[model samples]
Target: MAALMIQGCGSDVGKSVLVAGLCRLFTNRGYRVRPFKPQNMSNNAAVTEPDEQGRRGEIGRAQALQAMACRTPLSVHMNPVLLKPQSDVGAQLIVRGQIEASYQAMAYQTRKATLLDLVLDSFRRLEEEADLVLVEGAGSPAEINLRQGDIANMGFALAAQVPVVLVGDIDRGHVIAALVGAKAVLEAEDAGAIRGFIINKFRGDPELFDQGRREIVSRTGWPDMGLVPWLAAARSLPAEDAVVLRGAADGMRQRVRIAVPILRHIANFDDFDPLQAEPDVDLIYVAPGQPLPADSDLVILPGSKATLSDLAFIRAQGWDIDLKAHVRRGGCVLGICGGFQILGRTVADPDGIEGRAGSALGLGLLEIDTILGGDKVLEPCRGRIVDGQAVYEGFEMHIGRTTGEALNRPLLIREDGSGDGAVSADGRVSGCYVHRLFDAGTARAALLAKLGGASEGVDHRVAVDLALDEIAAVLETQLDIAALARLAGLKDIPT
Candidate 1:
């Protein structure tokens, strides 16, 4: 029944990575641990098992990775409220892993109050099943402006009665002020919930920050948990936010240039992590106003939370023109999930499932037409590239059902005797609903070969595990694990 919540001074402060590392560290000590986030605002989601009602749910990708770190099965309750942004002012609300509704920013502010009970119910269920529940808070609790209906940070901590550890990112600078400022602004009850503070992503010697650490402890009366050094292994992990998408394409030495447009509502962009690790590949994330590199060997349209909107966004950016030109130049094109939907001749959303009820013209690269409705497909799949013998495995998470003449030339044949994706007659264009399509060793190599590049043929899943282990090892040496265990109220400690 013990729980500890990791809240941060601001967004992108590495709270997720810290929780994940701690989860792995404690699990390695033979403790049953689980990761939970009462609310998450991100489009990077992972599909989990079906609930009691037989409906599959989706959680934030970070929680799914933390579940792997804890060696536990992922549950929708791990992340009860997910906000998938569809536009600057609106997002689709997901309650217990199923789409609930879409609301504008101001509308959601009033609506979130009603969902706090649901968040707590999920937390209690998870608490019942584990020895230690590690909770990750979204954004800063210091936003007293957001304190009224806040289920994401201090509000959830106080409601769930979980002790909080405030994490500050030193790499972003002003670590001392950020930590102290949080204490200064938070209401007494919320401020008192924080038991300690941990400074993360420190670059230089920890000793140099002794005075700064002492200043924070003296000003806030919260003990210094530890100052964690920079963890390079975190780079190998899938990024859960688009903030990391910047500068990803800079300074590449690889021969094969593969470009991906950074959509406004990009979902599950982690599918390219495997390609990013390839030595012979240069994975460029093309931002708005930046044309898809003409010298690129391939252009990939990544998954998006809002297909029609992003399709419009690409057209507005003139990327569609760039893509057509790239195709004419013999460059290969691949689309995943929402991206796959856009490659077809037309996409119909009669029910307004994604947005306004309407049909949008697609890129017409594939002879398919997609109807955007139906229960979202959420399941693991195993198959092989139809054009080659390379085997692959990944998960499908999309709401569109596609059918057309292009079905006769599918990109992949699932093990379940089903075909999943369309391929062009000339074999230069392909699209599929599968995410993590490049994680399999043989499949990655085969795909690269088709684009005239050689792959080292490494299994991405194993690489991710090794990276987690490495981070856990670093945490073991840097953090006060015994103190953290005691803070978490672990009755028994393993040697």
Candidate 2:
């Protein structure tokens, strides 16, 4: 029952990617490994199996990918507490993959203490199943303001008795100070839990940073695990944050321009990563105040953590007006999950699942109405394109049940004899609850063909696997893999 926790100096410091790469590295060495995060604050979720009574669960997308890296099935225990932000001050709480409650920041802070036991219970269950458990911590343990009820960082490490390896992002600059300052500020018990530190995303020669590394080791008394170089292969993997949306529009010379609006509460925007990788596609994530490109071939409304709120937000940004003009100009429109709910005639939140209990008028692009109050549908599904034979695989994670005339012209026909989503009569507008809808090669090609763009059609799943292998190969050379294994108390190391 060996475990190692990867905490970071700050958010987006590559803790998730490091844990994922290590998971693959150890699994390749014939060790049974599992990835766990006691708490995750992200809307990029993955759907998993239904419970005995036919209810499904959701976990963060990073954990889902790490599960793949470990060659294991996805489980809710991989991420026990998920916080999906509905607004700047509030988020929906999920416990062990089930929707628990939605709370404001202060309210959640007070409530998190109650959930720590559940988080450790899940960690214990995972420990019983795997030889090595790679745990990823959320935010930074140095966040003293958040240390009181902190199930996300050092608190969880101390409670679970897992050794911690602090990761600092060199690409973000001030790596030395960030690492040292963390050690300086943390309470002694929390600071003592840190066993080592790793500098990630280094650009230049490693030898140049020798003095800097020494400074950190001398100051913090933590050994250097490795200085991980920037992994370009990580670009192929799905990003877990909307911050990646900033530069996603750059380096686009492709003929077909697919524009997606960056919603404030955007979730599962990684649905477009495969499109971004396509040679013939220019995927532009339209920022706020930036209108959807009028000449673009397609405008996709991506999933949102808060459907009604984001729908209103897009309207405020006047994107709805741009979408109408784009539709009139013959540009295609596609909506996924929450985005799909917004394409309908109306969205009703009678039970206030998203926010205040009320009905909001939708974009009216599809002849449907959505009632947003129900057990969230969370399941992986396989289906064929409604008007085409191309098969596609994706998962659904939404709380709305849609009903209307447009449903008669569903966008997909599930293998289970069920239908999903809807398509407009002219075929220019469509919507579906599926995320990762573009991961299938044939389906991606067929969808691009509708916009008159040629697609070489790379299977996204295959691309992810190759990227994982590439990362593992790099970490094998750069990182002290044997030292890490020993740190995790792995006794029978594969040569």
Candidate 3:
């Protein structure tokens, strides 16, 4: 059966959410549906079950949400080529679940066509196996400059021969122009894929869009796919962009509030997501002007995409001073990934990895200094928590080598007999390059124990999973499930 493509007029135009809603909508109507993105550029990702016996890949937040909606196991092929942007120009490419290489914007553009086969293969597999395949297109197809060989939008639609439903965000206030312009700009043949157009993020009464919808249809000659009222519940959805979304904060030892300074290059900020699941803990973002929330008991410095730059920003905010005071006042401080580097000696970007000409001074917290190296650390690491710490076996994916610091009580000890991560003498100010520590139940329990909690009934992961289930229900209800199922042409499935 032919797939249904959710093409967008532009970025952030609600393609991902629409695809997700359609997936849930289809599933509710008794059809097994799946989500597919030919190519995704996101740093926030999930490791997926491999395909082709071992042709591995990474799962994305959108795909993860889809899987949870369809109630299927997550697989890497769902999103084959992921570009995790490390800097403004270049991104780390994860192909089939491995760091294949990194590419700059222009250099990568010419090379992207080579990936079309993999994206098609993955999409076709999902199409063949699932009852309905809901494919999402990236950006706008009217990008004629790139559309010549584009694999993300119209190029994908034409190649796959799928019917497209264009989406325009009304909240952006250019809904009509975005829709009509997209129609006017695309090649006559390229525009054939568009079956209809939908207006999303409608704020007021549905009838208010009657005239606007009529005008769009009159001008574009595209059928109306309904002006979807904004679903306020969408804010509860998990974020694929770490820049916009937040990590969870759970288990504070009462009267303990942790402040995590949002960084310019913050990566995997979702590390704190599970932490937010806790009822007793309060998580606050410490902006430069906003003095650290007065109630803050712990200050967390998160990972950054650019270690050197973010470290410099951290110090500039006088947060370095605030953090020092925090330590003096017997407050707790934790740093992760790039933040871990900042806590150590100077972050040297000698090769100009982070655009730095040379090495800079460290925070004088840990005895270590990190030199931005050529190799990137990307692997699932597991080990025992240092002699006694709140963290557990976690993963590490950073660039740079950390050396120095005392070893009595480490943050994590490798089962292979290597020691990594650092904790202070008082065990309050600590740093680790690992993310996902919050997802570790043992670590959460340990944190609660430290905070004087009777958290025996609190299972953080379970709470999150339940929230997902509720979200799935919401997606099933507000979305047009029956039409989406008919669109996918999936055969009936028994509940």
lDDT of all predictions = 0.91, 0.90, 0.72
All models, RMSD in angstroms? 1.1, 1.3, 4.2
Between candidates 1 and 3, name the one with more favorable lDDT. 1
For model 2, which pairs clash? none
Pairs of residues clashing in candidate 1:
none
lDDT of 2: 0.90
What is the lDDT, from 0 to 100, of the residue 140 in candidate 3? Answer: 81
Return the candidate ranking by TM-score, descending.
Answer: 1, 2, 3
Off by over 4 Å in 1: none
After superposing candidate 2 on the true structure, give the runs of residues whose Cα lies further than 4 Å from its correct spot: 50-55
TM-score winner, 1 or 3: 1
Candidate 2: clashing residue pairs, number: 0
lDDT of 2 by residue, 347-442 (tens): 989998887788889999999999998787877889999778999999888897899999999999999878888999999999999999999999
Q: Which digits, one per residue and each the tens of the lDDT, describe model 1 over residues 1-495?
A: 878899999999999999999999888888789999999999999988889898888999999999989998889999999999988899999999999899999999999998999999999999899999999999999888999989999889988888899999999999999999999998899999999999999997789999999999999999889989999999989889899998766746578899999998899999999999998999999888888888999999999888898899999999999999999999999999999999999989899877778888999999999999988888889999986789999899889789999988889999977888999998889999988889999999999998889998989988888989999999888877777777778788543
